[model samples]
Target: MKIIAMSDSHGDRETVKTVSNLSGNAFFHCGDSELSFDDPLLEKFHTVRGNCDSDHRFPSNVLVEIGDKKVLAVHGHEHDVKRSMMMLYYTAKEQGANIVLFGHSHLYGAEVEDGILFLNPGSTRLPRGGNEATFAVIEWDKTLRISFQNLNGEVIDSLEIKNFTKEH
Candidate 1:
């Protein structure tokens, strides 16, 4: 399955539209979009609510079933991700999610712990930690391939997870 992952756009609708133009079986918006829940531009996304979001229509978290992967998507603020991911990790495990998508620190990162893949696509509007604004794409099957890209569709980083399994 192919998936597009992005977060923290903070109301930059055009950038989200541009990035969503890419091909994918699923699209995920990890929140802080500052867009309405039913915004036309975000129509294709499985979105969660961010701390900055005022839309009551947006859920705090969302569960998406992509291929054989159970993905849990969150904004990270309510879970205090900047200080620790322990709570978030527990939530994912409890949800039976094999993949967790989140954004808040505006930092791009990816890591696997005890068979679960956690990804932060960074902030497309205001990147932090000296990184450029970016989003992420994933291609998963027997292996997982991740690509972090800028608004111009330029790849900034790439990673391949050959050991990520469906059964977390």
Candidate 2:
């Protein structure tokens, strides 16, 4: 599966549309989308609510089963994202997911832990540190492969997930 991940849009729906349309794949907005779930363009999108989203209609976290992969999606604000990954790691595991997609730090990251893949697409509208606006893609074929791309569509990072099995 090819999936595009992004977060912290803060309300810039155009960038989301641009990337979402080009990929022709499912889009996952980690959080801080700052838009109503009723968004017209997001009719087919999957997302979770962020700290900024106070609407009870949106959830702060979600678990989605895509093919053979179980994915945990969250915004990370409630998880104290910058301080540690311990909570996030365990949360995903508890969900029995093979992949975790989260944002809120507005940074890009990809790593494998105990057979699980963790990914953050960074912020497309308000990036932190020296990072540029970015998003992520996951391509899987019995294995999860991740690649991060900037707004210009240049790949900045890549990783492959391993140790994934029913035992995990």
Candidate 3:
């Protein structure tokens, strides 16, 4: 399965729409979109509410099941992700999720620990810790591949997971 993950767009509707068109089996928005809950572009994204999000209609968390992968998506603010991921990791473990998607620090990164993949796609509007606005694309079959792409769809970074795919 393939997945597209992004976060902290901060209301750049055009950028969101552009990323939404990328090919993937599933799509996720890790919050801080700064868009209304009823926004048309959000229809195709499995989204969580961010601290900046004033929409009560948005859910605080989202669980996505793709193939054998159980994904837990959150905005990360509620779990104080900018400081640490311990609490969020515990939450994902409790939920039996093998993949965790989040954003809040506006930083782009990915890591695996205890057999779980954690990813943050950074902000596609207002970015931090990097030069350009970015998002992520994940492709999985027997293995998992992640590509961090700039707004213009140029790959800036990439990663592959082999050992972690047993449960994915």
Candidate 4:
């Protein structure tokens, strides 16, 4: 399975559309879209509510199943991601998720700890910490291959997980 993840668009509909159009079997928007829940462009994504999103219709978190993996998606505000990922990690672990997706600080990063993958796709409209506008693609076969890419699909960083079995 291939999954495209993005977040923190901050009302830039065009960028959201661009990322959503990229090649992937599943799409996720971590939040801060600042768009209505009924927006047509958002229809393709499994989205969460950002602090900037005033619409109560969007959920604060979402759980998605892909292949044999369970992915937990959130905007990260409730867990205080700007401070630390500890809370998010524990929450995902408790939920039986193998992967945790979140966005709050507008910075792109990915890491694996205790057999779980944590990813932040960054801000496609407003990047921070010297990072460019970015998104992430996760390809799962025998391994989990994660690539952080620029708007033009150029890779900025990549990670590979060779031991991500379902038992983990």
TM-score list, all predictions = 0.97, 0.91, 0.96, 0.97
Tens-place lDDT per residue, model 2, 90-152, is 898788988789999998998887878888999999998898888998888756678888878
Candidate 1 residue pairs that clash:
none
Q: Candidate 4, residues 1-168: lDDT per residue as tens digits?
A: 899999999999999999878877889999999999999999889999999999989999999998899999999999999998899989998999988999999999898888889999989999999999999999887798999999999999998889778875
Predict model 3's lDDT versus the native.
0.90
lDDT of 4: 0.92
Report how far off residue 164 is in candidate 3 (Å): 3.1
Quote the lDDT for 110 in model 4.
90
Tell me the spans in candidate 4 whose CA falls farther than 4 Å from its real position. none
Q: How many clashes (backbone N, Cα, C below 3 Å) per candidate?
A: 0, 0, 0, 0
Clashes of 2: 0
Weakest ten-residue segment in model 2 by summed lDDT: 159-168
RMSD vs true structure, all candidates = 0.9, 1.8, 1.1, 0.8
Better of 3 and 4 by TM-score: 4
Cα deviation of 96, candidate 1, in Å: 0.4
Candidate 1 residue 65 Cα shift, in angstroms, is: 0.8
Best-to-worst order by TM-score is 4, 1, 3, 2
Candidate 1 segments exceeding 4 Å error: none
lDDT (CA) per prediction: 0.92, 0.82, 0.90, 0.92
Candidate 4's TM-score reads 0.97
